[model samples]
Target: MMILKLLAPIILFAIAILQGLFAEKINKIKWLKITLICLLLGSLTVGLIIISLDEKNANNFSKQQKDNIDSLRIENAQLKNNLDSLHRALTKGMDDRSLQEIELNKKVSELNIKLEPFVKLALTKYPAYDLQSALNKIAQDIENAKKLAEPPILIPNAQEISRDKTGLNMLLQFKLSKNQSLGQIIFYAEIEDGSTAKIVEFWPSTKGGAFNSGPDSKMIAPDGKSSRLIYSLIGAGNPTFDLKVTKAVTVRITSNYLPEPFITKIE
Candidate 1:
């Protein structure tokens, strides 16, 4: 169709040139003029056919391009809808996590409130027992509950300590100068009967002098074992023991608010 369209105009022009060349002879010959006129009419017919076919083909190409564009737009819309759905899912997950954390904190606070009286009674009545250790156990249980409530992907490793364990497994020895001695000792105590132990008083056995009272110093290990260190200044009228003495120094730790004491030897 396109080739015919291009050739139609050239053919018509050539026919006109031939007619002009035969103009003088046409007065002598009627058949030649008639043949030229017929040729011209045939060229016009061919040109009209070529124009009609070209327009039809052009309309078909335009329709195909429009269909392809519509398909691309539909696919793009579907992709956009999928992306929006994914974003909404992610937002919902975050909101759920936030609510879980809020509930967990509330439960922990309530547990602490309920355990306060028991903890106080244990501390007051059984100074030999470690009430703080029991409290720590309660805190750990709350933490474990919170962990269970969390998503599997966000859960952490267990942090609870064993019941059989007491103070830090590691040893700590301090060398004292003449002016200072063991003062206050804070430690995580584990009792064999499952009773909590507390340090009420510390004293030197030989001199009947009390250790200096102050804030507790705690030492903790990676495995959750811990102990405390206490030191004291020599009191008036109390005999000063030589730090270089080869003999072990005996110290008594009184608990349960009782006059009876437990003894520990330090070398």
Candidate 2:
């Protein structure tokens, strides 16, 4: 713009001199006006051309921006769809888990009801016994009850037993840490008296104390921690010189590890 301004005055002076010398015959004023008017017209034409090119570039820039926006919208839509699909999958998994839990609970309820009779028999006859052994008996019965309850699968194994330090008496026990998740389980056991028969007792080992034979499931003993149950059977004070040994009792220890729940008689 400065170069144009500098050249405009010089071009005007030359044109004016030429007009004054040739057409006006030394009329300088009229020739100067014509020269200035010519310069003004040339400046106007150049300015208009620049303005037109700027407007064309602006239109092209606007079109490119619209295309970029359209592409971004498509990508955004696809992302939203993927998120929705994942949400649906997560919700479905939670629903399936709840249904399975309900079914499992129902089956357990039915099994407990079917085993009620056996449970009462043990409670009445072996008033004194071990809780752990009772649980083991239940496991055994479950295996045995398979013929009656065919719908469920019960893994059968030989009853477990633990011998005492003297090797004459036995200890019995079972763990619910594995079966605890099942909530509750009921069991039963028996001591058959024969030509060789004996007497035994039972007690519960829980967050409670040893079998003081004083209370049911909720008793806590003097020990700081819960006691494992120990059931015992000692010889009846008198021994006869009979040739035939008539006193004997066959006891199935819950598992060899568990001993009967007993302590010095409270009496």
Q: What tens digits encode model 2's per-residue C-alpha lDDT throughout 168-193? A: 22223333222212212222223332
The candidate maximizing TM-score is 1
In terms of lDDT, model 2 sits at 0.43
In candidate 2, position 89 carries an lDDT of: 92
Clashes of each: 12, 26
Off by over 4 Å in 2: 1-42, 138-267
For 79-163, candidate 1 gives per-residue lDDT tens digits of 9999999999999999999999999999999998997887886566656758787666656767888866543211111111112
RMSD of each: 19.1, 19.4
